[model samples]
Target: MSVRIDITGLTAERIHFAPSPLAEMGAALHALAEPAHHPGVQGWTTSVSACLDPCLADRMCEADFLWRTTFSDVFTPSAGLPGLHTLPGATLGEELDLLDKLSDEQFVDAALEFTCQSEYARRDVARLDDPRARERALELAAARGSHQVRFTQRLLEDPPAIRAWFRELMQDCDEAFFSDVWGRVRHQLVADARLKTDLLRRKGVADALSAVSGSVSLDDSGRSVVVDKISVGHTETGSGSLVLIPTSLGRPHLWVLHRKDWQPLITYPISSPGLTAPTSVEQLTLRMSALAHPVRMRLCRHLARGSYTTGELADAHGMTAPEISRHLSVLKKAGLITTRRHGRYAQHQLDLSVVSRLGGDFIEGVLR
Candidate 1:
């Protein structure tokens, strides 16, 4: 199961892996499989299905080149963080020269607006399964005049309600829901992979910065990651114009451009550039580290969708109540997530900011 293949369009009847050369050429990939990095081993199986069996070796070579030219260039210097590979620290304090380059007119509508709308779209999706979420989505849709389909608006307005409806529709949705959602996102990701621009147009970075702006000052851990603000403005045609390049502290070579031929404004997170980019590095690290614990990690992963109580977490993760409580205590302490008192039950929900940070990094790391 480590490898998957679908060579339907290719002339090859079967694909074979050159064990020695392939393994030797892919040490970085193997390194990525280390438990300390990405937990799911399947995430590291960099497989490619080619049409011609004869070209399998060549394809593997190409895959190796891609892995090197991409992941290694970004991830290595970040020092084993699974998310965004840390950019070079040496380039710190570099003046945000891109702002100077931009003539006054080029900077129009704030990039924050688009990033906010996009982030809202994502958050809006999460509530799709919940009835309450659906209602909220509809309200927002009405307010914003998104005019998405009424049903779509409903789904968007009340995610919790919609999610509950979806569960009822699908019946026994937990198992199938993840697969379906993953398929949706992965399919879109794979399809987008065909174009080079898809890698750079990472909508998540802007979203992360939007969330970060909520913070007044980031802690020491947050300081390690630099996020420079990009001056965004509206164009005469009524579209967003990003005057600066958006970047991650861990990534190099990959800078956020305007998705067009605009000037590339390279910037850093000297102090969280904006609200989307939270000064919660300490919270992030602490939360991730707390989740790193096998029991809690499994619990969090298992509960990615539905709400779960302490008992469910304990039962699912194979830990005692006391131990689970300890982990939960750490998680809440780190502000990675929170617990709500629901009558006799206490439910845990992952903080959206933390989720955005991790998600933003994951998107940046993989897409880049």
Candidate 2:
């Protein structure tokens, strides 16, 4: 299953490429929370962990819900989250200032949306429209985990207090380590945004969507964007726009935020020296070398038509299964193909986006 974005009538103006400090901050926090998920930044993570204040680290650990689930919806482009909804601030401090100025009414509505984790709870909260309903929602959320009980309670009783509390946590996080990390990666993020924007302007919507992430693909009709995600859902950007927010911290994870009366926002990873530059000189060489083989080139051409299993590819190429598997492994290592399981069989398909970016990557790598 995949998340399909229906872009049947979206114009170039309706598609936006926003480089956001707020998004990067959120991504950095997520990486901090789950360092194991981002293996490439282990060195940076180690240094930052050493620099992090003990109390700040403890507080972040306590707010596991914020990073683990939908509780951080306040930071997303939800109609309830005012001043921060799809607004790409120039700096994290600017975003924090907007968060600091959040009105009581706005905080209550946004916190309410986040606190009600389930549709049934949200419906009851809306239907009842009472303090008790809000309390019930908090209790349900608290019952799910002990970590966020006090925070959700504060959300129910004193919205401003909870807001201030999280604001302080965010501030401490910024002061402790994220600011340094942001300074290091900000330029690369902007460059990636500029690259995608250029692709959008020059190549139109299909290529533009393809440039978002390796997992994102535009269907043949050019009306739908197929995103490879664990959770299966369909979102249609009817009159709303599609907002692309680039982050340098959260590699290999694409986060989507869609809410009523707000544009659909996707926070995708674009780490420096990877998306913005070559991972290594060896990567360019590997990609070139993988396709240089005549058999592998023909294999890629066959897979371009459709996906195939090892035996099927062997049969088509008149090679043994072992030989074809070896060839496929080289292509896979170079990020030229993706393998997916179909029942008991593993089927491989060409990753067109990665292949398409090779020429540009080569040019940038060579010039640099």
CA lDDT of each candidate? Answer: 0.34, 0.70
Candidate 1 global CA lDDT score: 0.34
Candidate 1 residues lying further than 4 Å off, grouped into runs, are 1-275, 351-353, 362-368
Pairs that collide, model 2: none
Model 2 RMSD in Å is 10.5
Q: Write the per-residue lDDT of candidate 2 for residues 1-368, one digit (tens) a residue.
A: 55677778878887888787766777777767767666778788788878777878889877655664432545652323433234556877677666666556445555555545454112333412476766676677776577567666666677777777878887788888878888898888888888998999999877876777666678899888777654555667777678788877666667665544445677777745434423344677789999999999999998888889999999988999999999999999998999999899999999998888888666543422
Per lDDT, the best of the predicted structures is 2
Global CA lDDT of candidate 2, please? 0.70
> Relative to the unseen true structure, what is the C-alpha lDDT of residue 272 in candidate 1, on a scale of 0 to 100?
27
lDDT of 1 by residue, 221-305 (tens): 3221132222222111012121212222212122222212232122222222233433334444565677777766766675567
- Report residue 250 deviation for candidate 2 (angstroms): 0.7
